[model samples]
Target: MNAKVRLGEFLLTRRSQLRPEDLGIPDYGERRRVPGLRREELASLAGVSVSYYTRLEQGQSLNASPQVLDAIARALRLEEAERLHLHNLARSSAADPGRRRSPAPERVTEATRQLLEALAHVPAILTGRRSDVLAWNRLGHALFAGHLDPGAPERPAQRPNMARLVFLDAHTRDLYADWPAKARAVVGHLRLVAGRHPDDTALHALVGELSAKSADFASMWADHRVMACTVATYRMRHPLVGPLTVTQQTLSQDPSLGQNIVVATTEADSPARTTLALLDQVTPQHGPARPTVRAGSG
Candidate 1:
């Protein structure tokens, strides 16, 4: 996945998604060959030469300024996240060529572990880029991945990916009543990661593995859906905790650790909350369950 190809593909997609009328361009009532704006029309809107836009779309001219990138983004009517992603992609390509890429994360810090331990009562987990449960609190372990061990070293390179579990693990599939929606979200998040980190060989490999293994994944990946799920309410059915309607909150990890911390909570007077309380009473203390952390499946 070369950055140029990704940039071009995204541009092409956005271009095709816009109708002439949507962009305030008058149509001549002729039958259209494509779904969206033509290349020349887009180039004209962005105030760039048609030949230059053609070259950029064809992955010939790799260098594009932030101003030019922003122009193209506005011309295509990109959303906030998409605009940021566009800049990130262009910036990544601007890095010195031939730098060895380290896609997979090795380890999170002890400070991060202490942070997780400090929030033992909250259902909080610090996840790597691939959604690897790097450090999870006791309540977090019980809430999201009940069967897994909380006290385990989840290095980015060596850990279970949450996306893999959603599709491959039977228990996880059963947990989500609307499994397809959740599945789409996982693929979408992975898609965003792929776009931002195209040089990430490990990410590419992970995506390849999932695409080959799950047909659902293959279909969604092909659709090119991309979104970041910062907040969501999940309907979960855990073996011990019964049914739960937990609202999830996501916050970015500190700069040193490029991860996200997810916290889940239920309404105070809800049955789900009561079930959580019961689960706490039954398993009050966090301990060293096993040497290894089993976050879903193979």
Candidate 2:
């Protein structure tokens, strides 16, 4: 993810979605080559010169001021996630071109492992930047990826990726009731992560692999949507548990690692809760007997 190119693409994608009338501007019914606001119109709305905005959009400008970026964000009608993504792109673009840093290790802390063990009653898993399952509780494995080997996450070379599973794995695809919506949300969140970690080589590789393998992923990737998955409800058709609705809550333990603890829950005394309890009864009470793991690229 080249930051300059990403910034330009983000701006272009967002700009192409808005129409003149949508921004309270008069439409003279001029035949324009592109949809949405023209460069001059966007610049005017953002309180900037057309030439300057053109330079920015062309990836020829760096060091965009915070005020200018904020103005452009408002002009584009960007949501909170999109606005943050734009700022992240701008910041990454301005970073020294020759500067380099080693990729941060994606490892679950011992403390987090303990927490995962403590939260034994709930379906929970830990995921890193590329949505690779770093670790998972017993119920999480049974609830989400029971078809795959339960010990996959322990093996670095074969770690299961949530996005890849959703888009490429047959079992995962069959698990969701609203597969398209789930796929879109996955791609959207990945866009936000890509903007924030522009230099992540592994992330680039993951995106490239998914784009090559899944037509759905390729299409969604091209959309350039940005989203953050803090909390979401999903309907799943588990082979063992039948239909269940789970509300997933994502919590961050370390910002620098870009890892999250994802825990799934159901409404009290609901059918989904009963189904989850049944699932618990079928699975082992203790954690997986083995510690095998899986990786996204493996």
State every prediction's TM-score relative to the real structure.
0.84, 0.95
RMSD of each: 4.9, 3.9
Residue-level lDDT tens digits of model 1 in 56-174: 88777766888898899899888777787777666665656688467544466678778877876667887777777777777787776676545553433446578878887787888
Name the best candidate (by TM-score): 2
Candidate 2 lDDT tens digits, 1-298: 5788889988998899898888899877678788888999999999999999999999999999999999999999998888899999999988996886867678878899999889888999999999999999999999889887778888878899999999999999999999998899899999999988888889899999999999999989998998788998999999987999999899997788889999999999999999999999999776765444577645
Looking at model 2, which ten-residue stretch has the lowest summed lDDT? 289-298
Off by over 4 Å in 2: 289-298
- lDDT of the structure predicted as candidate 1: 0.77
Error of 1 at 162 (Å): 0.8
Task: State which candidate has the highest lDDT.
Answer: 2
Clashes of 2: 11
